[model samples]
Target: MSYSEAREMFADWGVDTEAALDKLAGIAISVHCWQGDDVRGFETRAGASGGGIQATGNHPGRARTPDELRADLEFAYGMIPGRHRLNLHAFYLDTDETPDRDEIELGHFTPWIDWATAQGIGLDFNPTFFAHPKADDNLTLSHPDQGIRDFWIEHGRRCREIADGMAAAQGGEVVNNIWVPDGSKDNPVDRMGARRRLEASLDAILSPDYPRERVLDAVESKLFGIGVEAMTVGSHEFYLGYAIRKGAALCLDMGHFHPTENVADKLSAVALSVPDILLHVSRPMRWDSDHVILLDDSIRAMAQEVIFAELTDRVRIGLDFFDATISRTAAWVIGVRNMQKALLEALLSPQAQLKQAEAALDFTTRMILTEEIKGLPHAAVWDEFCARQDRPTGLALQSRLEGYQASVASRG
Candidate 1:
């Protein structure tokens, strides 16, 4: 199946394959830096992985330093088509002087800014609210102790500043996402108390108003984690209301919800209230395992909803998974490309025809057209996309990945 044939087929259904490719090329997925290093950021005072965050595999060639991680990211980006952004956590700061999470300054992240600028890419940020001694009790911003809550609040404030600096350096806005791991292993008597403290802490952190064009704040929620199974402080309902009231973006992590829950369904509901949305595209193996994403129904539905509802500008997509079992760079390339593929598939959908059928109350035509769309030559169009970007597809892509894996096997 050639691209021209595929294009003609799509055209017969009132879909423009060329326009779809152009849109796919413009959509940038914020590739997470943590994936390259198994979420082990370069903080000198880094503690043991805790707060429900754990990267399980001992894949050799794990990036041990900032430079190594950046090198791995560069290689992954080469295989992935289109310009994208880098999602950096606060702990990933690269500097000689040691800085605590609350004390981190933009100087510590200068190297990353410089790298992104040179690569002609954008930047995104996250405040690391886990794996610290203060978070040992599975609480940070919502901790019972006022002093402890204040400390985490300051960390959040500093992260926003760093995000502002990054946006200034890149000459664009940076999505500053906040996800706190504040929950009890068992049911707590003071859920309301903890939530109140969290609300106060967040208010304090967001007090200093940064320019919206430079720093786009987003709050993420989780259903449960390793130890916080009983109750997560930042649950979906909590953040949904908070985002609506605070005028911030609500982050919907694919792995943060129940396995049976369709994250795609929430897009339209939340879009009605929140100013914007930030998606953490991930795969959960019965839980928030942070496995690399595949081009499965979950991803396809997400892409289709964004396109079908005309919410492209309101939604910001980013990848969030860390699987150290495979070649780290390969994981990145595979996950990002899958996301691109899903978006392209959605873009090629005969949306006008589908909507017309639905509006006319013709369920049979809608169902038939949708079923037939699955048989379209999407793979041919995908191949053309990679070819246009000078990237390999099919067996060639696999061969390149194997060669890179072999090259990195020698890394200590």
Candidate 2:
């Protein structure tokens, strides 16, 4: 079917295909760099990833160097339909020096800024809170020992410094995200003490004044983790209160919550209180699986709420998943394209009429219309979007991904 016909069909449902396309085009999905190497960073002294995080699979052609990862990302970016941001971990530094986490300097990431500048994209950053020796007993920022806590605080400060540097070079706010694995496997007798230490540590890290335009500091929370099966010091409540009280952005990872819980449903509630929040879009088989995102019902619901609340500017969307089972480039391409597709579908929904129906207490009609709109010609609109972006639509990019895997990824 012609795109014009699909647009007309959508218009009948009070959906603006043009506006949807425009909005989708403007939404920048933050592509994660870890997928290219199964969360392995190109550090001078890289080690195993700890902090209750692990990427499974022995996929060959994993990018083993900074240049190789950049090449893979460049190829992945070409297949994606929009200009997007890249998310980087502190471990991905391109320095010859083996700087400790607290000693990491801006020079370490100068290469990243250069690459981002050339690509015309911005970069988000995260502190490497795990896999370090100082992270003894699965705690860093919240470690009971004062010296240990100080080390992590310095690391956080340095991360903010690097983020600010990147922003100065790239001309946008670099989101400096901090996620820690500070908890106990068994129920802790002194939960309050641990949380108190965590709060103090965070206060210290964020005490220094940095340009808000240059960097936006955020903290992520996890419900539970591998070793910290019983208690997570940085729980949802902890980060939620911290974000609101401290005036920082909170990161909501889709796979971080319980299997039955819907991170999408929490959007409005969080938006109602928090000024701005970041989203770590991912898929979970049962827990925090970090499966690559797809255009699934959960994703659709989240996008719907974002549009419904008119919180596009307030919400920063980013992809946060890594799978070593598939071609890294293909993983990036699929996750990003699916994210865009979900947002596009959300924009194409008959939101105005649905709201009116709900206000009028017409639940039956609302339900019927909701199910019916699912069958809309969204695919046609998406194809037109791909064409407009000068990208191959649908499965047309399959051969390209395969060819890149053989020709490019094989070299890694």
Candidate 3:
């Protein structure tokens, strides 16, 4: 069906397709930089991927240098239809000097800020807490050794400063998220002590003064991972309380939660307490193995939750996954387009009527409406969005990606 027809059909249900498209266009998804290079940043001369993290597949054309990564990112962003943000880890800094995490300064990321200025897109930052020598035992901020903990604390401090610089460079707030793989492979006897140390370390890292308008601080948690299967230092429960108390943004990584737990359900719960939250959208297969996102039920539900809670302003959407099995550019395009499609689906839904049905306890009507709305012409609206944004729609994007891989990526 034509887009106009679909828009008219949606209008019958009190959903303005144009308005939905406009709203979706404004919401920026923070695209992860690690996806282009399989997380192999040139920060440290580090070894293999460790700390309960692994990227499967050895897809060729991985970004080896900063220029290559930036080129690949631009290629990926061209297919995506929105004013999206770029997410960078501290390890992704472009520099000849392999400075330690604590030693990193804004000068190291000056090129990145300059790039962002040229691209006209904002930037996001993350403190790299894994795959470093300090994380040898999977304990960083919560380490028993004061020196190790101090190193990570300093890293966080520098990360915040860099985030402020990025914000100033782009004239937007940089969401600085901290995700540490600090835990024990075997159940430790000092759980309380570790958490106490972590809390104290976080307090110290966040103690430094910075412009609140420039940077937003967030802490991410994990259920468990390869070495830290027995215990994780920053569980969701731990960060929830900490975020509530410290007034920091809580990062809800979809893959970090258990399989049975719906990350969507926690959105409203976290929104009610925290001032704002960061969403790390990634697909997981039985574990926190970061896979590319798709237009699946899980992602759809998460998008619906965002719409239902009216969290367009309170929640910042970010992509988090690296699948090297396919073309890195295709992976980025597919994941981000799927996320945009899901958000479009939620935006085009008959939310007010559904809410009214639920309020009146009209279970039968609500169920019928919910099922009925699924068959609406969301695809038409989505294609229209792509067309409006001047990006290839559907199968057209695939061939473009293949062409890119054949011409640009394969040579790289």
Q: Which candidate number would show the highest lDDT if scored against the true structure?
A: 1
Task: Give one digit per residue, the lDDT tens place, for model 1 in 21-93.
Answer: 9999989999999988877788654454467788989887889899988888888889999999999999898
Provide TM-scores for the models.
0.98, 0.98, 0.98
What are the per-model C-alpha RMSD values against the true structure? 1.0, 1.3, 1.2
The whole-model lDDT of each prediction reads 0.91, 0.89, 0.90
Error of 3 at 179 (Å): 0.8
Q: What is the overall TM-score of model 1 with all chains considered together?
A: 0.98
Residue 224 in candidate 2, Cα distance off native in Å: 0.5
Clashing pairs in 3: none
Clashes of each: 0, 0, 0
In the range 233-347, model 2's lDDT, one tens digit per residue, is 9999999999999889889999889999989889889987787899999998879999988888988888888888898998889888889888888999999998888888889
What is the Å distance of residue 318 in model 1 from its true position? 0.6
